[model samples]
Target: MFSKDVVRYHHGHDHDHDHCHEHTHTRGAEVENKDEKTLKILLLHWVNHNETHEEGFREWVEKAREIGKEETASHIEKAIEYMQKANEMLIEAKKHM
Candidate 1:
């Protein structure tokens, strides 16, 4: 569960008003140009975290193979494929920076 403070901070919520998008708020910006640098940093962090998860999934795949659980291994392989696609999408997004 997300706390009120987290909601206020991340969603740019103002207690004076009853509203929150909870995602993609630009409350901190005071100029025409949005903060691309911060967004890039966030994307890089996401990529790093996804890579870590991929490593864990790889371990699970190896363990499944060792235990002769091909079905489980195949599922992890599909997850890894999705992860790779996500990483590729992020890489494509970086090109805009």
Candidate 2:
């Protein structure tokens, strides 16, 4: 569950872009630009969320192997590896930010 302190902030760009960005703002003062700050928050959230999902996937992998689904389990393990790689990139991005 998301914390009550975090609130969703929908902000529209004044540029010619046709799409609007939806960002989350925690209850506090922000010195950074809105878009960059929200992006950093989102990246952290995604990393944590991915960790939870990876744990669930590992549990399923064990169950799959127990039921004689070795191939399926292998695929899920590969997916977990890919997710780790993606998270590494996200972390790097946040570092640059």
Candidate 3:
């Protein structure tokens, strides 16, 4: 008789191994990285502060465009791009922190 039921294992899956890998790190060493620490703080700050900044930036850009201020709109657009990059970096830093 052919068994209709089948089991599948995906990446990082170990059928025979019932336990997960354990990671160890030195105390204070991980947290002492200035860049990483700064990133974590920035991430948290952004999570709270980004909403206002993003909304204002969007509104300003839209208004600028509506008024046919192409130069100002372009500048605001560039600033938005930079803020996006900064936000992304903070996110990545949080992952490491």
Best by lDDT: 2
List of clashing residue pairs for candidate 3: none
Per-residue lDDT over 1-97 for candidate 1, one digit per residue giving the tens place of the 0 to 100 score: 1123322344343232222223544665533234564567557766776787799899999999999999999999999999989998998898887
* Structural RMSD, model 2: 10.5
Candidate 3 residue lDDT tens string, 33-94? 64454556557766545555777888999899999998998998888888888878767767
> How well is each residue in 16-96 modelled by candidate 2, as lDDT tens digits?
212225454664444256666668777887788678779989999999999999999999999999999999999998999
Give the candidate order by descending lDDT: 2, 1, 3
Compare candidates 1 and 3 on lDDT and give the better one. Answer: 1
Overall lDDT per candidate, in order of appearance: 0.71, 0.75, 0.63
Worst 10 residues of 2 by lDDT: 11-20
Q: Where does candidate 1 clash, by residue pair?
A: none
Q: Where in model 1 is the C-alpha error above 4 Å?
A: 1-34
Model 2 scores a C-alpha lDDT of: 0.75
Residue-level lDDT for 84 in candidate 1:
89
lDDT of 3: 0.63
